[model samples]
Target: MNGTEPEWLLWAREIQATAQSGLAFTRDPYDRERYEALTALAARMMARCGGADETALLDAFRAEAGYATPKVDVRGAVFDAENRILMVRELVDGGRWTLPGGWADVNQTASECAVREVREETGFVVRASKLALVHDRARQNHRPAGPHSIYKLFFLCELLGGEAAGSLETAEARFFGRHELPADLSTGRTLPHQLERLFAHRADPSLPTEFD
Candidate 1:
């Protein structure tokens, strides 16, 4: 979710997946061409809805066909002087202490994505200083369990500026260490071990950044 890929990529994938599957079983070349047109429509939808670079749109589509998966949304791991991680009480899952972040938008850089997600969820302005880590939400061997396929992106960000304010997406915005995690955690959004790993990055800079 920390990259432009999610903005249009998900929509396009869903569309093209269905269209390509439809085209493959059909014997008529005319219908195949029509399915091809559907694929193009899907790509254009990604370009318009995602606002990504036009020239890269088809390339993005072509790149996806061979052993691909859905784009994982991005999340932010923001910490403060108290060694506590910032948490949001999300509205979608009945309010929990997950990190501040959402799906990546088309126009922003990955760092910009980290900043946007934090600000939107916590009402805190942060400057992303590091490309801390990337995580795969699907087939999460590193994580204990899984449901839907997803990828998770975590960034190490500094609190550059802002006050803690809540919005429609989040209710209460606060900072907590490992001991203070909320009981009603939105696990669909984040897992406890992922938070722990983010803290591990903060505690030891020498740890290799990871993606899985």
Candidate 2:
């Protein structure tokens, strides 16, 4: 998932982020009006070029009430006894497989989010053992580019117990050898190279944490 982002999309995201921050801190009436207008402009830009619904995008943008910042997504790389990687089929992505994880929740640390996501999505009880990587989702070139910027955290988790099972968000959970990964991966959630890096880290825990 290393692809170039469309220039317009990048500019639109910048505009949206700036406007959101302005709305969060501004007190002057004129500034508020300008930021609100910028939000609408960004929504129109995305709708026209990115093929998104303007109303929905605007609503989502306005739903945030804080200084605009990249959202965090946590992914857990849980390996089995045979050194195979644990993955789950995301129901939200039409059943495409990805490492078991999701958005980092408020009031939870990165490791906590990884542990919870793995359990919720795959029914796998795990302990987050190491932080492997922190990547910018856009910089990684994840597919189906999203409006909001995101920081993705990859953690090496220890598989303690629990059997493979599906939750509301996932269809099933399974482990795959390095050479047998599924073709249809939910790239927005996990990427091939990212998984390879995780495997490398598992092989040698001395590797330093990676960041983008």
Candidate 3:
């Protein structure tokens, strides 16, 4: 984990999520008020830990104005007939290879995000088929945080055809078999188990999609 998020900030994030959960379960107005106060305290702590203005942090917290939840992260595992996995290296991750993926946008479903990310990162047009796996990243024991709160949705994608190329976000692209996983995998963004699930899906179409 980077020193960018101090222990205090991490504590505040947990407290904030807990406070939101409390609001969901509490029925009494007094209990709701207490939860709100905890949320404000969490915001203040986050502000202090992140070196942001307290007022701004509080305002941002208030912007939600209701039960809050974490964001969703989605990824795609595009495979060829040979069962080789398509991977891309992103500049943000020091050009380390990963299966293409990104955060779920406001209008895009998990499948859409998967396909979108694949195309954007690898310049490959692919259709997201069955949802292969849904992983709780926090439970996955991967990195602390890659870019945002991500619930990884790895989908089985079929190539629709596009020239393999790199963008500003991606610097390299290639295909790999199970034994050829690059040493420079972006573990912070992609985990081995997550990829393993995709490989299993590719190996067996009967495997059910596991969700959180």
Candidate 4:
């Protein structure tokens, strides 16, 4: 575990995972009630720890009704001939820069999700060439924000076509060289070392995929 992660976040995530799994498999009415209470407790913990509203947290937890699973986030690392990396300024993160990516939609393959996200966010067509990394968000040196576990997938992609353009989720689309990266990065989506690793992979396509 990253020592920087807050104790409250650790406790809240474990409790939420347990409660979600319990609710998924328990069929008895009494057991269901117990699991529901546990879910409430988890929500309360997150509210107290994160300074979020208890009622809203509870509602969010209650809405998640299936077997517990880590949410998958897909990212694409598209390098141009100059080896600069494609990036987008996220509207939701105060216009901080990040690789083009988002939550993996249902019914889409991971590679397909990466391709779609890159095109949608940066208006640049790409073909996912290889799976570069599979990262556990908690295990990485990323800023903490949510209660659920997250699995981040980074793919090496070849840029195909399309002009740089911004979408509703992105404020601007551009490429940055290794030394020219923006300091205000959306750490929840992309980190400095991760981008460095992608650059390394771009230099040598034979490197094996990285994992948490």
Best candidate according to TM-score:
2
Residues 1-212, candidate 2: write the lDDT tens digits.
Answer: 33478988888989999999999999999999999999999999999998889999999999987799999999999999999999999888788999988888889998999999999988889999999999999998899899989999999999999999999989999999999999999988889999999999999999999998
Structure candidate 2, residue pairs in collision: none
Error of 3 at 173 (Å): 2.0
Comparing candidate 1 with candidate 3, which one achieves the higher lDDT?
A: 3
Candidate 1: where is the Cα deviation over 4 Å? Answer: 1-69, 141-149
RMSD of 1: 9.8
Best model per lDDT: 2
TM-score of 3: 0.76
Candidate 1's residue-wise lDDT over 113-143, tens digit each?
8789899878888888666668766334432
- Write down the TM-score for model 2: 0.97
Q: Give the TM-scores of the predictions, in the order they appear.
A: 0.67, 0.97, 0.76, 0.97
What is the Cα-based lDDT of residue 81 in candidate 3? 76
When summed lDDT is taken over every stretch of 10 residues in candidate 2, the lowest stretch is 1-10
Give model 4's clash tally. 0
Displacement of the residue 151 alpha carbon in candidate 3, Å: 1.5
lDDT tens per residue, model 3, 1-212 = 43444567667877777777788778899998998898889878866666667787667665654455677778888888789899998888677888887778987778888888888888899998889888776556665442124477788999999978898788867888888888778876688877888899899999998876
